[model samples]
Target: MSAALDQTGSAGHWSPVESWSRDELESYQLERLREQLGRLARSPGHYGDLFGRMGFEPEEIRELSDITALPFTHKADYVASVAAAPPHGRFVSVPMSEVRRIHFSSGTTAKPTPQFWTQRDLDRWADLYARTAHAQGVEPGDVFQCLFTYTWFVGGLGATLGYQRAGATCIPAGSQDTARQISTIFEYGTTVLCGTPSFIVHLGEEIEKRGLSPATSKVRAIMVGGEPGASVPATRKRIQDLWDARCYDFYGCLEFQPIAGECEAQSGPHIAEDFVCAEIVDPDTKAPVPDGTPGVLVVTHLDKQAGPLVRWWTGDIVVRDRSRCGCGRTHARLVGGVHGRADDMLIVRGVNVFPSAVEDVVRAIPGLGDEYQIVVDRSVRDDATGFLKGIRLRVEGSDPALPARLAEAIKQRLSIRAEIELLPPGSLERTTHKAKRLVRADD
Candidate 1:
C-alpha cells in the first residue's frame, strides 16, 4: 500500500498523499497503472484490440514514461465504439449489472458520450471531489450551493456528494433562476458557492442590480469549474472582487471526475497524482512536452473501474509544474488551469486565437461588462468558397470610446486585428452554466 494512503494527514489536508515525494507518488501511480493495464489486457474490449494492434503488452510497461507508448483514446474513437455497440460501449470494463450510475459529456460536438460508473467508481469520484473541496476549505459549517447542471452532466451530483462527504450542508441548487439563487444564498448562509466563473459573475451583477452588495454576503469561497474563466487573471480578480471570496479553479471533465483543484495558495490547481497520471503533450504531435510548456492535457485514470480509460486525450491546453506548492502539496500543478480546448482554437490571419485569450484581454479593460461573444463570419468569394473573413468581438458596454480602446488592446495582446462590436449592457445572453464564447454568425 502507498504510505500516503496508509497514513492520515493534518487538518489542512484530506490525505497524506498530497505531500508525498515525487518518487513516492510515481511509485504508487505505477502500481495502479500496471494493475489497470493488466485488467485491460485480460478483458475483452476496445483496449484489448488496441493493444494487440500496437503489439504492446502491459508487462512491457516498466516505467511511467512507457505510458506514452499506449494508444490515446479520443472522443471520435469513443463515438465510433458506441455506434458499433449501443448504450455502454465495449470500453466499459464491467457488466451491465454492476453499473450504478450513467453520466454523459456535455455533447457540444455531436452526440453525448455515456459514462458508466459502478458503485465503486462513483464512490471514488465522490471521494476525489471531497479531497478537492477540503483543499478549498469546506468544513462542517459551510453551506455549499452547487450551480453546475444537475442532469446527465456529471458536475452537479459529483460535487454535491463530495462536499457532503466533506461535512458541508450541500444544496443542489443547480443552474437556474438567478434571482432565487441569490435569495437562497442569503437565507441559507451559504459560505461556499460552486459554479462556472461566468454564472458567479452574473450572480454578483444581479446582486448589485438589486441595490445589494455581494461582498457583505457570507460567501467566503467560490469554487468554479466547467469553464476557463476562473483561471484567467482578470476574470479571477473580477470574481474575487465581486463576491469578496477566495476564488479557486477546478479542472475536470465528465469523462474524468473532479481530478485537480487549487489549494489555499491559489497559484494553480494541483493534479491528484494518485488518482490520475496527467501528461502534457503537443496537440498535433502527441509527444510529451517539458514542464511549463503549453500543451494539450492527456489523463489516464489510475484508480477507476467499470470504464477505465487509458491516455484519454482531454484537448484542453495547459502548462504543468512539478515544484512543490506553497500549500505543502507535492502533486504536480496545472499552472493557469484549462486554456480552452484545442478544437475550439481559431486561426485568424496566421495567428491562433482562443476565446479565453480574448476574454483575458476584454475583462482587463476598465468599462467592459462581464458578457462577451466572439462572432465568426465567412467571406464569400466569386467561386463560392467561403473563407473565415475575420473575428468580431461583441461586448456589452456603453462607453463610446470602448471600441477603439479594445481593438488596440486586442492587437497588442493577440497580435491579430479583430472588429469590436460594443452593445449596451445586458444585450448579450447570460448563462447559468458554461458560457458560450464562440459562435458562427450563420448559426
Candidate 2:
C-alpha cells in the first residue's frame, strides 16, 4: 500500500475526529488503546518486565480510564536503560534491519536520546503531521517552504513528509542562510513557512532590513515548533505582525513524533490522542492532576514500532483541559502551550523563576522585540545579605531606552530587580532554530 493508504489504515479511518461527537471519539480511542497495549506487552525485554512488575496483563487496560493503574514511565528510566545498553536500547520492538530513520532528542538536559522509526512509524507520524497542516489551513496545491533544521532531527523531515503527503509542493530550505531563505520565499511564491519562533523572528528582521514586506511576500501561514514561545500571545502577535501571516503553534519531541498542534481557531492546541496518549501529572508525586491544572506532561506512543514508548515522561510543564474545545475535537487540549521545563527552574533567594516567566515579561515590553537572553550567576559575597542574587538581562535592540524600560517592567512584574544590558544591533548571536536563552554561568 502507499504511504497515504498505510496512514489511513493505521488511524483506523480518516474521518476527522474534530467533527465526531465526544463520546464517539472516546470510544474509538479506548478501542485502539486496548489493542496498542496488547501489542506492546507481547514485545520482549523491558516492556515484559514492566508488565510483570505492574501485576496485570495488557488486557486489563481495556478501557481508557483503566490507564490510571499503569505505572508512568519517567525520562530517568529511559536514560538509565539507554546508558546500560549503548546506542539503541532494548526498548526497540523491532530488529535493527527494520528501522529506516533515526532522530536524536534535543539533549538540553543531558545526553541526546536516539529514537528509531520504522517505515510504518514514519507513515503514521506523517499522517498526524498532515492533519496538523490541514487544520492550520494548508491546502493541497499550496507550496510549503520549510525553514526548520533537518540535521538528524525529525522536525523538518516530519513536516516535509506531511506537506508532501498532503499533496502540497515542499521546498526543503533546511534552516540555512536567512538572506537566501527570504529570497526563496519570494522566488517560489511559498505560502507556508515552518521553523522555530526565534528563527522566524530573525528572518522577519532580515526581511525588514532588506526593505522587504512580509505582507507582500507569498507567505500566508507560519508553522512554528521546537520552542515554547510560539504559543505566547505577545511573541505570537509580534511574529504575525512582522510576517503578516497566521502563526500556528506545533508541539512535539523525538520520543513522540506528533504530540499536539493548533488549528485555525487559534485556541489551545489539540492533543493528537489517536496516536499518542498524553497525561499531566504532579511533578513530585507522579499523580495525575485535575483538569485545568498545571503539571508535567507524560506521553505514550500508540503506533511506534522501532522504539515503542509507553507513558514516557516529557519533563515539560503544561495545563491540560478535558472539557470540550470549540474546535470540536474530543481529544484533550493543552492550554497556554508548554509553560516551562521542570529542570529549567532557577531558584534565587527562595523564589523560583522560569525562563518562560522572564520571556512573558520581556516579550510583553512594547519596544523590545522577541530577541533577549537571561544570564544567571551566583553571588560573589561570602554572606548572603540581600534577597537578590545575580540575575542579568541581555537584550538585543537598536533602540537605547528599550532595555531600561524592559528592566523596570521585569522588576514590577517579578518583584526582583534585574540588571539589564542593551547590546548593539546584532551583538547577540542569532540561531537558525530554537535559540538558547538561558545560560548558567555558575557551572
* lDDT per model vs. reference: 0.87, 0.79
lDDT of 2 by residue, 165-211 (tens): 77679999999887888888899899999999999988888888888
RMSD of each predicted structure: 2.7, 3.4
TM per candidate comes to 0.94, 0.90
| lDDT of candidate 1 over 249-356, digit per residue (tens) | 998887888769999899899998998999999998888899998899999988788888999999899989999998889999988888889988877766787888
How many residue pairs collide in each prediction? 0, 0
TM-score of 1: 0.94
Task: Give candidate 1's error at residue 325 in angstroms.
Answer: 0.5
